[model samples]
Target: MEINQWLNSAWFWVGIVLFIVIIRDIFIQKSHTITHNFPVVGHIRYWLEQIGPELRQYIVANNREELPFNRQERSWIYASSKNENNLQGFGTDQDFNSPGYIFIKNAMMGYNPPVNHPSKKNPGVLPATKVIGLFHNRKRPFRPYSVINISGMSYGSLSAKAVESLNKGAQLAGCYHNTGEGSLSPYHQFGADVILNIGTAYFGVRELDGTFSMDKLKQKVDENPQLRAIELKLSQGAKPGKGGMLPASKINQEIADIRHIPMGKDAISPAFHAQFSNIPEMVDFIESMATETGLPVGVKSAIGKLEQWEELAAYMAKTGKGPDFITIDGGEGGTGAAPHAFADHVSMPFTFAFAKVYQIFQRHDLTDKIFFIASGKLGFPEKALLAFAMGADSINIAREAMMSIGCIQAQKCHTNHCPTGIATSNKWLQAGIDVTLKSERYYRYHYTLVKEIAEITHACGYEHPCQMTMDDIELSMGDNNRTMTLSKAYGYHKTAIAYEYFNELIDCPHLGGANARNRLSR
Candidate 1:
């Protein structure tokens, strides 16, 4: 018989039947629920809910609001973030066809000012070191503003070129670049005056065997005295309690070594640290790191439940073991690859968090001991002023800076195929980014914006940008009916809180569960 005839025989039919029976026995039979119920294995639903959706919504871009970003806003950031030419036609990609589409006229009443001295001016100067808190008067003794700094950004998530470019920009701008929880990269070493951020993973500075390494941490920081600060990243705005995750594709020899991990596998930072369990214990670890390294230390976090913040604050107040600075990331953070649920459902938007933390610090009267740096969309002159008004000692802008360097605001940061070369890690793509060229825009954006904000402070009748307070102006109506005045809008000045506040009181859903007061009592 031919091949078909042979295969169609009884024995062949029996063989196929046997294979199906075996597969059914092994996999499709039953006990799938049992297999899934194994601790984190069952947590698929939770993970999917937290991060998966936001990522999808942002990537899909169906609606006008960019989900995570608005279309026009994202475009503006991408264009200005990069150091490339701002090339476009008819002003924007916005459709004039739509009835609701609003456009600015060339002869608009306002005089748009040009940047006078983009890179020529001297950097802002104040004191040799920053002093936090002016809570007390000093006929005998009081306090001052602290030289707080920015926290880390993972080298793995960010391109080597991007990180280098940021380092140059930060150094010129007299700020610190954080070496995010993915651990420190050798590239970060070049920007040596960094704040060595020991993220939850303890990725870098770990021994070859995967334990924490004091020698490595010290060696790295000690070598560069400019690496003047340290921050223990407890959590982040994108997904708090959720640690760092590096896909196998992004993990390379350099990353593996810096993070002290094996090759050929994605690195997952455990949600819980092996060393510390509770908030107090976490503080102890940060204190240990700071003491061990002889540098000012702090923790980075997306503010959580109020009980935790109060307990930690109370404990720190009791023990005098608080970190030097508290870097507060509002929930509206994490532009990189993150689960939608985490970004949307879990995180606290920065405006509220920053204000809450400021209140908490004042409540504990710890404002002088610790400083606050606000992240999460801290861009645009207007936005920065708002952050300052909300009591953020320093403001940071990642996506905004990306705009100055010629980003088109694609918001496709997770894809290494970032057309602007601001987010991708591909070697060939990275090679094309000339740090020298990008640095100019970064410098220009920082200087120009600072000046613009300073102008706002002056317009509002203040001394410096830092002096821009809540009592300055009134909120007016939008062209339609959408406007909130300054005094009535931003919690009504630093000392005047119209409502109750807590740093860690996050409502995963706006509907609410735990109240801020409840958390404090707990």
Candidate 2:
């Protein structure tokens, strides 16, 4: 082609346009140092950085190398959610010799329920052995139908479709869904029982000035029959002692309406509750809420200092008036956006934190009184078993539930760009989730998880997971092939309170409906 003809060609015109745009971006855009310094070539670096997580997840990293949720863990959840074959062929890839390794001590003769057992007929329907608020005599005390329930992941932090799917799934699976600290949005009303999590800002039941309002709380409870309980958020695992701030830019009208906050202004949650400053006052506040709402009241917190927990336990033991349940969140828990330092090092991990708090309550003889809930990565059957053995009456799962509904753990939760639509609120991104289909997926995941836990329980000669004690667990000490009982390692002896409760229920004719034989299945 002639030089004049080349200059007038389409390719030549495209090059000219690109060159002009690049020159303008290089000089005018000072926000990105690399692009400003290296011009068009630096664009390649940003693109690579943008997709770095995907490349590492799918191509570079091994199955177990990823953080938060590795390929193996994610695969198990995905397969379980889809009701696919999740059984491993070549045994575990775990390093048995590794220090801190834990495993359940299977009984020589596995437990076999009677042919007429509810579990045999309905598989995966393990109900709580103890009622949630029976001890407190709340106006509406009831036993939780499933031991495994969905943990809190706020509607604002997650998409509306995600919340709706989770609620529907919880309903199908006979499990409760936690309306996270963001408040009770319409999406959380899909016929599932809800534990309303009231954070420091008191989102759903807050006054115009962001203070907690008892009248508003009563109205919420009265309006939503599904609001079975309330969880006062003292702190979360991801950011202990740190309050949250929802940027005005991310606060849409829906969020503003749900949270009862004005739009176009930052919604700030202070580090501490304005209602109570000390343990006694906090107990009074909890009791007041329980009285007003006629529902069980609980507190969720990540452990740091021991003094506050000890004080709370001591006070509760003395007065017998406090939270009906206590949920211990581990430092490893995620879902909320947090500072790197706070997320990594602020609070104790679940096992250690739970041990400390459990010991404190045990010392006060309050262990059997309050419903103990465990959170933070207790999704898998083995992990969940360990938690129950450590004295957890129930377990809550957040990330695992999100994964079941289509989260790839892209870790873009804080960026409003989740690819699978579980985390992000962006309409285009959220359109990826089919509420009905994903809801079924979540149901399958929950049902399968509870079923597997029951299978493991029966293998361990136990009727229910809560009946397990630390004596049934062992951990490697990282010494010369040394092993230690979980009870000894944690420096506490877990009582057979749950087992005793199970026995009592089985003995009573009227309460037989709550027994393992009549528990929900399938």
Candidate 3:
């Protein structure tokens, strides 16, 4: 009776209070929970990025003793930028007797060496013209450059500062800079040479409904005297035989304005050209564009099938409608953004496709008339030499150039947060890239690297880098499957030089000594 009476009094109220306290502890909130120590606003990532370069050298950077595109590439950039000796002070880290690496090609005892220059039957390539070459008439056609020119990289894909820097650098080097599938921004106009890429997304020069505008393209060409080449990007090497799409989240007002695209809509670039299906149609497209503007029109492809190449070649020959050059990109080539599968495994490797395409041109007797430009990881002198040796008239290097100017190649070019300011769609990040400092570095990198390529040409028993031929290259069994020279290998081949040396007359100019031949141009 006493307990029941107590339950209805102060004791019951105390019990309820205790129960409320227990419920709060278990379900409502916990005062003792752990919390991560961070700066105000949780800026750990940003702060980390602020010190990323230093931390990376100590942590994630993979070291290299003798590999190309390794620590050596970085070291070379540093040394060249400061005008210091690029060679390490220490003795060679490489194996002196290693036959696995092909270093140089040497001559046999009293071997009568013959002069081997690059192909002479090249198309007329005027550095400047009145109109965009692609829209010009083909009757008395402009000379086709070797099918390879720098592939598309728009100011939007990269920073405006970065694009202007690259275009200026390309102008200095007498090569072409592709305005990536991005719309031609105002800054890209500063360069002396520019090739506008019309991407599937049809950015920049597109209509309100997202169709291509020839009139806008012509106007762009007329406005920018640097606009000399036009490339129709049907498909890329990294994502061949596939369509292209960009998320709406990636599209901003700047991109929309440059690309002539509406905001808040998914960006789509269909895999195949809506207006072109067969080779004949592709030719007509090229011819029509050439007629529309007086500039070189070309196609950049990542070869998907052998039959397709054969058919395309046959059609071009049959209709007498040929693209000035064919830029055959390797599947392993780099890109700002693409599906992982296509970048890694979808298309033919450069070695395989390079040989096939070279053979195709030779077979059709179009080798001399149509130029071949090879792209895909060709940023270094050795890699570029390899492409030239594989029958490329010229080659383009993109990522390597990025590397020379402090890009860590985090493969985050698709992201606007690129720490180096090389590739980003954002302007604040673009401010990080100082054009003056970067452009001079670009000049140094080009001169030094091209000089190194000329050295390789000389080591291969040639006068100029352009004088190098495929027969001059030999594959090694090790590290790079390295292609090298006879002197570097120690074991020389007489059979390799037998036909050239034995068949040629000693006094002939065609059999001139390597040094007596053409000058290596700057």
Q: Pick by lDDT: which candidate is best?
A: 2
Residues 1-522, model 2: lDDT tens digits = 699999989999989987986887687877888877777778889899989989999999998778898999999999999999998997888777677788789899989998877677778677777777778898877567788999998998889999999999988887889988999999999887789999999997998789889999999989987788899999999999999988898899989988999989999989989999999999999999999988889999999999989999888888889999999999995899999999888999999999999999999988888899999999999999999999999999999999999998888888888888788778898888899999999999998999999998999998889878888989987757888888899988776762444345445423322222343423
Q: Per-candidate RMSD vs. true structure? A: 13.2, 2.9, 11.5
Query: Candidates' lDDT values, in order?
Result: 0.59, 0.87, 0.61
lDDT of 1 by residue, 284-348 (tens): 77666766776667677787677778888788777777677778888876645567788777857
**lDDT ranking from best candidate downward:** 2, 3, 1
Best by TM-score: 2
Model 3 / residue 72 / CA error / Å:
2.8
Q: Over 4 Å off in model 3, which ranges?
A: 1-62, 65-69, 89-102, 106-150, 246-250, 478-522
- TM-score of each predicted structure versus truth: 0.69, 0.93, 0.72
lDDT of 3 by residue, 195-221 (tens): 778877677777888777888877876
Q: Distance (Å) between predicted and true CA of 172, model 1? A: 2.8
Residue 66 alpha-carbon offset, candidate 2, angstroms: 1.1
